[model samples]
Target: MSKPAADHYESLASIPAGSSAHRDLSATELPSDGDIPRPVDLGDVHCFVQRHHLAHHTVVFEKAAIIVLGETPLSSVPGITATELRALQQETENKWKQPKTLYFTILVCSIGAVEQGWAQTAMNGANLGIPKAFGIDSNSKHDAFLLGLINSGIFLSVCLLGAWLSGPINHRLGRRGAVFVGSLICLVSNTGSSLSLNWPQLLAFRFILGAGLGINASTVSVYAAEVTPPLIRGGIAVSWQLWTAFGIFLGFVANTAVYNYGDEAWRLQLAGPVLPTIPLLLTVYFCPESPQWFVKNGQRYNLAFQSLCRVRNSELQAAKEIYSTYLLRRAQSKLDSREVSWSKKIAELFTIPRNRRAITASYVVMLSQQLCGINIIAYYSSTIFADSGFSAFGALLASCVFGFVNFLGAFPAVLTMDTFGRRSLLLLTLPMMAVTMLGAGFSFNIPADRPAHFGFVAALIYLFCALYSPGMGPVPFTYSAEVFPLSHREIGMSFAVATASFWATVLSLTFPRILTVLQPQGAFALYAALNIVALVLVFLFVPETRLKTLDELDHVFSIPTRTFIKYQLTEYLSWFTRRYILWQKNADLHPLTVGEEYQALVETDYEEEDMP
Candidate 1:
């Protein structure tokens, strides 16, 4: 052992620039307290970075012994030199290069998201045939309202119903089981809708279909978050939106192919989402349950660790994750036991100040998602295009264009959301969407007799789809899933989805009536104004959750709502401005390393530990 009595401790020997390529860095080893020796040599550091799974080390090649675990050294060893940082950086690089298994799990869970996307477009794609079959006069105002209700109202209302039930279902079933039950329900509901003999029958079945989708949406978003490793969590979580867009695009294309068959073809279109549900129900049994959920529910402790091992890519990483995520999922000791019942949990959402902000922010984000008037374009694009003088074939084709643009649009958010932070992306995209929506509304006043005018209007609507997709489309569902503590995650998201359902029902029920009373231009202008208000709310209230992990959020949300918002926004703007030249070039935001995130989160916690 190196002399501990010496004042200075410096790195002793060479750490080859490139360590052995075969060193399995995926699973780091963390020794117990008993394993550490006494009378530590300050200069004899031998481990890789002298790192611990949960502690931060900053071994300076100087007169101080390195602090590994507690404030004291573990068997005084020569400290790791700065050169060893090269290996440390390399190991970080490997962590993010996720294995095929992680990708496979994400891809499979995203199948449930496809149902979410399909729920919107299925009727949008098929609604073109609704008027003829139901004998509703397409040109009349009342019929237009009825048409909107048929397309969006029923589905959203029952979807809300399903969202309400998701809490208990998922609590009982686990993530995989919840997904299984929800997908099977959707399959059955879609088939029933296809066989509907009349408009009322179709609407009733559509409601059931919405309930199924509600269950899927509520559970799947949480499942996506729970299953992912923290460093890469945000990106994987946002893919829920990506897959939803894919489903919408797929629905539109299928509708175009079958629309030529006239009214009867709608049956097949309604039934088509059933095909994707097949893989979801079949594939879920292979997927692992959520470790965080297991910890929260207080069951299957061994299985939770095993699942965490698979998710984190190694046993040691899984142990660290349990320290970070699993502990935070529960309440701190004071409130821990208060997690007594669902009724108490529900009451706690509003009773605790931080919890209140979390759920309120979640509720409002989802409410805005629906009220922003994107659905007007999504669900009634066929009607809007036809009003703009497109033929029936042309209208259906235009809807397909909207779907494709929406699908492509989500890629930008999928890429940037975790990097620039959620709030930053919202600031950039919401204003752009607001502008495009107003432009779309004004197009109705132009000379529709001219092809240029119609083209211009169609282009704006498509642009709205593109802009909305990247920010508004995916952010709300993901954001809502992210904010709540583990215990309330399911119920909170269900409440948020239910709020979305209420607004969806309201908008779908009212949009057509507004179109008749105010015309398309006025209706859209109103929604644009609402978009501006939502943007302000987000800027002034919602905290930036860019690289912050689920555990750190407990403290983050505890900051006075307005104060945290102001600080985060200031931080964001300062960073952007400092890099203004680079910002102009529009480079993508880079992802955080697992070590970086863990260190950042624990820094404050550690400081508190040092306080007298």
Candidate 2:
């Protein structure tokens, strides 16, 4: 082994293993002595950084170490000046002031999101023209089935192949390489889709496009999360949803612009997504590879350090983060000493308690994302508008307005996701989503000849999209990307994405018949009820994960599901009732106390000195 590798192993060996003693603590009871295993101490982490980092011998390294520990007196550390101390403090305080390279990386990821949104909206526009051009009767049951199949073909491919492929592709190619390959496939498949002579040909190309969407969707949020700092991670990670909304809006604009192009307009709409892929293809290679990817793939500490430096404003911040990430990986590897085979990793996602809880949380968010009925609007809003008595041009315009609402709604999350938190946002928005969807569905009850009917339905649909953009829209991907340990992150995310894609396929395939049988009223009511169920599940299962480092999430997920549920039901529920329902102004809800095992692994006793 190389000297650094040898030292790395030695560092792992020196850290104490967590206790295996089992305790049957009650759900509401706080853990007492020996009830939970203790994580590695922060002093040990400081030691690891000092020993392994080549720059540790310098005065700058000393100051960086003190800042990282967050407790050391600057005067106690030799060779540290007041000006140097001020710079270090500024790095943490002004969290948004990141390196230019980091912003560029987020931009690359955002373009990838735009590609995904544009691809989805292409079909939304094409749906209006394709059935007629292919001689398929939308009113015929058999033809309706065929139309649904064609519409859902891409998502079926995503669930079956693309989501599952993300892990191995990421494992082999790294995040940037996976994105590049996915974008290339999209470019080719989108062209093929536009040129298709028949429905079957278009379906085949759509399936190919699914492969790209699945890969990009699974990889981009993770890439963004890995590169971002904990303080601003939510805002940065949410760029995927935010830009995707932009892309959706642009796709609608394209569809409206080409509505006058005769029967071939659908073909042009289907090709609209191909534009964003070109920029994604050209620029993706320039972004830095994820530093966490390096740490997990191999003990490439030097390369990890370099990658971190490119994204962070200072080498000191880079040094602090790399060592912190490295230590957590080491701790996780000790806990899970199994083989690294794909099948084994998949099994671990369920078999391990920490991972299982993460899967449960991921499932709650991802499943809810689909069940909240956003894709129903995304895929078939034009058809819905048309059915509600809109002209072909009017349907396209109304859909465009819907897309604009979706895009504008996402900006709030960029501010609130970190402050309001992931779980809180989901809980807050779901009930509103349910209410708006119910209102929209019932609005169809008004007479078609009345102007209020059109105004009410359109207004309610827009409101639903607005509510969805901030909460379920961004949280699932961001939450799924961060919940799993580095060992199983790719596979865990694959499972989560697969869950979403599978349900999207089901919704796309069945909604046409649903609209036929149940009409708009019943269809909307069913999904509104589903939104309530999703809200209940979120209340019971999903844990809050905002503002925590990817490594720190291990502790959050380590708390038993039953324990978390118990706390929510007994503590949070009552608190909510008293605070909101009863209108108690001074009601306080106690924070959930974690065992030493659940505390942040990198926390130290060092206190920050006041900076002049």
For each candidate in the order shown, give its overall lDDT on alpha carbons.
0.69, 0.81
Clashing pairs in 2: 70-606, 71-606, 71-607
Compute each candidate's TM-score over C-alphas: 0.77, 0.86
Best by lDDT: 2
lDDT of 1 by residue, 189-287 (tens): 889888988888888888877778888888887787777766566777888889999998888777778887766888888888888899988898887
Model 1, residue 200: displacement in angstroms? 1.8
Per-residue accuracy of model 2 over 1-612 as CA lDDT, tens digit each: 122332344445454443232111111122223333332234554565555564453444445544443444545555666654554566677777778999999999999999999998888989999999888855778888888988898899889988988888998899999999889989999999999999899989999999989999889988998898777776787888999999999999999999999999999999999999998999998999998788767767767888888988677667667655664466446644656788988887776677777898898899999999999898899999999999999999999999999999999988888889999999999999999999989999999999999999999999999889998998998888888876677888889889998999999999989999999999999999999999999999998987775434756765667768889999999999999999998989997767664432113111211110
Q: After superposing candidate 1 on the true structure, give the runs of residues whose Cα lies further than 4 Å from its correct spot.
A: 1-91, 138-142, 319-335, 550-552, 561-612
